[model samples]
Target: MAGVSLYSSPSFSVLCLAQKQKLHFSVSGDNQNVPFLSRSLASLRLNSSANPLPVCKPFVTRFSDSGSSVAESEPDSSVIKSELQSETLVSEPVKQEPKREELFAVVMVGSRQYIVFPGRFIYTQRLKGANVKDKIILNKVLLVGSKTSTWIGKPVVTNAAVHAVVEDQLLDDKVIVFKYKKKKHYRRKIGHRQPITRLRILSIAGYEDYPAVALSDIEPIK
Candidate 1:
């Protein structure tokens, strides 16, 4: 028992005993007691005498005819199709036009200079007497640039002018100002909003003679 494995022991050797018993049963022809497996092919033949599975038929739409043309055509398919088409058109997003290169000018509105283009809006320091819808022509154009050519002035372009209309005079966002003195314990906090004017650029003149760039010919910025 010290050197032998558990399976090799006669008391634990169940497989050997079963095999010996099977061989002894086979020699004695006692197959019924041994219970050997008997395999028979399954019957795959379906019953022709039984009712067949129900067959599904294609669905068919029926329209009623009441002898009146107006009543019969009220629920027409064409009307439904047109309604669906209209719904689809309403749901579809509007296609935006592609952006094209336009003439731009660098003009000085007040002490600060701004780059302006036609139909675009800009916010500048409040014009003193400018009112809403009042057109103002800016003559201090430092540079005018386009796709084909550029015009740069020494101090300011003479003929170059930018026309803009005052859209609104509004106050800008508040800026918090805080003053502090460490030793004296003096603290002051205040907020200020600078008055600004909104201007819609109507046109940039003097550069209309330059060639306009086509949408496809515009080069991508590197």
Candidate 2:
């Protein structure tokens, strides 16, 4: 029939299995010895065998490569213990370097001004009869700054004094001055060096509102 299918025949599976690899298919049957039917039958019989594959085996997986590498590269237990000990060091806050106070004082000495700091020296115009290591009080504080506060004076603060010790008495380098009058043919040459004193600031004291240190309940022997 025109609507007939080859797969509907009884030998479909057998022929498929036989020719699965080659992908070739054909069929024939006797129908009153027709020439076309005879040729089809001969072709079908010529390529009837199949080459289908057999059933597959079960699946399996293993990680021996990764496991073997890890095993081979492991450190000794003692090394591991030491590393663990190092990592377990006591945790503490980061200790930063101590910050210096930004304290300074502006004091006047011999008609000159200076900004002095604790334990630092400043040069001033020569002080009469001042000797090295002689203690002196600077009573002309114009301004004073502490770590957290500043005090200013209208002209000069009262009672604020800086204690200092004379460190040196020295002269500045000589400076030369030349005066000339070309038409009058007159010339004057002069050289001068000024005297200066080096004083090391010891401390600044005044109404700083510092915490009062408690006096001993009993006075100590002088």
Say which candidate scores most in lDDT.
Answer: 1
Model 1 vs truth, CA RMSD: 20.4
Candidate 1 has its poorest 10 consecutive residues by lDDT at 37-46
Per-model TM-score, in order, reads 0.51, 0.50
lDDT by residue (70-163, candidate 1, tens digit) is 5866798889999999999889688999886667889987789899988899999999999999999999988888776677677776677898
lDDT of 2 by residue, 1-222 (tens): 643666667688677777864544222224444656665665576655454454343222235666777888997899999888887785566899986667788998877889999888888999998898999998999888776566776676667899999999999899999999999989999999999888999988883653222344336889
Per candidate, the number of residue pairs that clash is: 0, 4
lDDT of 1: 0.79
| lDDT: worst 10-residue window of model 2 | 209-218
